[model samples]
Target: MDLIRDDDENNSISANPPEGYVEPGWPALYSALHQDPQYLYQPYAIWRFTLYWTLLFYGFVFLVTGLLLLLNFTKRHPRLALLSFALWILSSLLLGLISSTIVAYALAALYNAAFLRMSTWVPPLWGAVQVLLLIFSAAANVPFFTG
Candidate 1:
C-alpha cells in the first residue's frame, strides 16, 4: 500500500525547502524556542543515549560479578570481597550517572545545532530525575559514617 501518495506528480522527487527554511518548532510549553535545528533533536537524543548507558551499566555489573565469582573471592577473604563488591557497585553507579550527564549534555548541544524545532524536555527531565536519585542515595549513606 502506498502511504505517501503524490498523485499529481509522476516523478517521486520531493521538493526541498529553501536552504535556511526552518520547520515549525515543537509546541513544548516548557521549552524555549530553539535558535538552531540541532537544539530540537537534543532532548530526544539524550533520552535515547542515557537509556543505552543504563543497559551498558547493567552489563558491566554482570561482567564484574561473573569475574568475581570465577575468582572465588567470596569463599576466601569474605570481608574484603564484600567491601570490594560494594565499592565496585557504588563506583559503577556514580561513574555511569556522571558519564551519562556529561555525554548527554554535550550531544544535546550537538543535536541542537543539527536539527530544528525539536523538543527539549526529555533530556533535562531525565537528567534531573537521575540527579535527584543520586542525591537521595548519597544522603541516605551519610548517617552511617562519622567524621
Candidate 2:
C-alpha cells in the first residue's frame, strides 16, 4: 500500500507522503523484534513455517466457502445463498479492511435476519458462523500478529 502511494508515477506529482512518514522509525520495530534475544537467534525457517500455516488456514477457508457457493448446496435457500455469496464478493472489495470493520460485521446482521425469517431454532447456515470466525481471526491477527 505504501509503495503504491510512494510512487510518483502512480500518485499525483503533488502528493506528499501520508501522515507519520518517518522512515527510520519503521525499521526500529523490526530492530526491536531482533533485540529480543529469543527472536534474534531464531532461524528464518520458523518464520517461513508461520507464514505457510497462516496461508494454508486462510486459503482453506476461502476455498471451502467458495466451493460451497459453487456447488448446489447453499442454494437450498436462494435468498440466503445469494446473501452469502454477496458477503464473499464484498470482502473482495476490501471494504471490510479499508472502509471499516462494520462492513465485515454486516454479515452477522444478515444472518440474524435469516434466522428471523427461518422458523427453525437450529443454526440456519454457516454464513454467520463463518463471518464470526473471520472476525475473530482478523481481530487476533491485527492486535498482535503481522497480518
Candidate 3:
C-alpha cells in the first residue's frame, strides 16, 4: 500500500480566498491557513526513512563483524568483539535518533519551502544545515563513546 497518496488534485491549496477573507501579512499565518498537503504523510515518511537507514547501518556493522569472525580476527583480538557489540549498541540508540531527526526536519523544511514559496536556495541551505547538525552530533558523541 502506498503511504503517500498522490491526491494533489483534492489537496491543492486554493489561490483565491473566500468572500470576506482577509489575507494575513505574517508568513506563519499563511502557513497555518494553507498547510502542506503532504503534512499528513510526514510521520510515516520519517518512520520509514529512519527505520530503513538504521537497519542498513546495523546490517553494515553486523556484516563487518561476520567478516572479522570469518577471518578469525575476533579470536585473535578479543577486544574486537566487545567493540563490535558497543558499536551495535551505539547504532541502536544514537543512529536511530539521528536518522529520525534528520528525516523529520528535512521533510518539514521541504513542506515549509513548498507552502511558503521560499527561494530555490532555501531547501538546499536547510539541507546543508541538517548535515552540519548531524556532523556536530556525531563529533560530540564520538568522544563520549571512545574515551
Q: What lDDT does each candidate get? A: 0.51, 0.38, 0.46
Kindly indicate the candidate among 1 and 2 with the higher lDDT.
Answer: 1
Q: Give the per-residue Cα lDDT of candidate 3 at 44.
A: 39
> For residues 2-120, what per-residue lDDT tens digits would candidate 1 score against the true structure?
43322324422122223453433333225245553232333544545464544364446545664675468877777877777777666666666665767676656654454333344
Return the candidate ranking by TM-score, descending: 1, 3, 2
lDDT of 2 by residue, 56-97 (tens): 344456557666785664657777777777676655444323
Q: Which candidate achieves the best lDDT against the true structure?
A: 1
TM-score of 1: 0.42
Tell me, by TM-score, which candidate is best: 1
Q: For every model shown, what is its TM-score relative to the native structure? A: 0.42, 0.24, 0.37
Clashing pairs in 2: none
Task: Tell me the lDDT of candidate 1.
Answer: 0.51
Query: Can you write out model 3's per-residue Cα lDDT over 60-95, one digit (the tens) per residue?
Result: 554565555546656767787667666655654565
Clashing pairs in 3: none
